[model samples]
Target: MSILIALKQQTDFTSTEQRIGHYILAHLNQLPTVLIKDLAAKTYTSHSAIIRLAQKLGFHGFRDFQRALTTEIVTQEQQAATVDANFPFSASDSVTTISQKMASLTINAIQTAQQQLDTTQLAPAADLLARANRIFIFSQGDSQLRARSFQNKLVKINRFALIAEEYADEAWNAANLTSKDCALIISYAGTTKIHQQFVAYFYEHKVPVIVLTGNPQSPLIDQATYHLLTVQDEYNFAKIGTFASQAAFEYVLDSLFAVMYAQDFHNHLQDLQQKQQLIQNGPLTTK
Candidate 1:
């Protein structure tokens, strides 16, 4: 989970703690220099309570917590900036015009992903998926669909794969995970609480985490054993609507699966074909 979400989940938030939380949330951009005593005084809480709050929020101490929070805030701001730079629309643009612009924006994002592609990251991530004793895939919101798709692709290769939706209780599954297992987390924003919780749990237990996300500087990136960066076009003026970033995620998944299949093409193809045959011929009924 992101620190903000962890704070919401774990902090008791006495009136004073609430004050501190509100202050921090309102001013996350300026957190790096904010001192514990200053925050305590502002919130009318004790320094120790603030320290405890920082720990509860998943930081080793105030400085580290502040650093993470600052990074997250800056990342959000940067995404907003990218969106502004790409999205040049006016109230006058028709749906057709807007759609064309959005397409161009998405194309730009894919080009950026092409430039940022790291062959080094791909091999290790493929290795993790190939060699893991067990693989768990976790994602929420739009990313959940992508996670399920990736899980299905992995199963084609006959690996022991589990989707977070199938294993809904992460706390239980995480207890059984070890260094031999792999955790693949997908997040577009890279700031979901449930995703972060699973990542932190796996990190603590020594399980490898492979993160696929748009923001490389995000806190989620810190927990990842392997990071694959994707780009999203943020140029839509309509904040409520979907944009082109999701296509980037799908492209990344497609590339990874292709690389994995190529690594052991013959055996992988045979295994997938066998699984398909079983599904087609062995099923008893539609029920």
Candidate 2:
């Protein structure tokens, strides 16, 4: 598990341990320079408590944990710095160079997503979708566009999925959701007011919600019944256009679709083939 995952799963930790975890999360960059004793003092805890937390996180000790964290911080900073949202190339660069950089950035994003994604979460999400009466999808902007693509995939398998792009539509769909329905929400920042409002409605209605987000510390984390994370480290200005975020979202959605499709693989495939055959053969006419 990553450092963020460790902190997210700190329910079993003691109060001191939880405090130390939160401190480390909030001040990740300073881990390289801060001493164990200083960290303990800051958290109002002892050195042993700090060491124990590190050990629990699979580090040898506080120093070892700090070293790993420093590496993570530096690597993230470097990747973020290299990203170019505007041109992704300089005036001197050729088209070939620009293409290579774009490919490299996209491939790297997918690989990082593969490594960071927790496969353990996929199975339960698949099971929920497989059993759901209908799937309600909530998202905005680029993420919503990706949700529409996933909704198309689900339609091919004869699964009912509704992608609500507007707030009123999302609220209407969510309000009508029953226990047998599921919600899949996609957001990069995970702090959108509209997303939160609909998520709250789903929570109150006892509807299972699956959220895909880039921010682990997002408020959607707690609201989601199943939360899948994606890292968009390839983008410098994330707001410009969601190249990496859209790629990661599609990758995750494809994985979920695969798992759900595998539950009744043959039947779904046959159904899809039959539908294709009907379309190819043309629509029926009145006799």
Instruction: Give the best candidate by lDDT.
Output: 2
- Steric collisions counted per model: 2, 0
- Candidate 1, run of 10 with poorest lDDT: 2-11
**Whole-model lDDT, candidate 1?**
0.71
Candidate 2 matches the true fold with a TM-score of 0.75
Candidate 1, residues 68-177, lDDT tens digits: the string is 77775565465455444334455798998877666665665555555456667878898888888988877766777777777777766776577755557766776777
Deviation of model 2 at 150, angstroms: 0.3
Candidate 1: residue pairs that collide: 1-196, 1-197
The prediction achieving the highest TM-score against the true structure is: 2
**Per-residue alpha-carbon lDDT of candidate 2 for residues 1-287, written as tens digits (9 for 90 to 100):** 35666676684799889888888888887788998889989999999999898898779998898887777667666655665533456679789997887776676567657756876778898889888988888888888888888988888777878876655666677778888889888888888988888788778878899989888778887978888887665443534467777787889899899998998999998987887777776474223
lDDT of 1 at 44: 83
Task: Tell me the TM-score of model 1.
Answer: 0.59
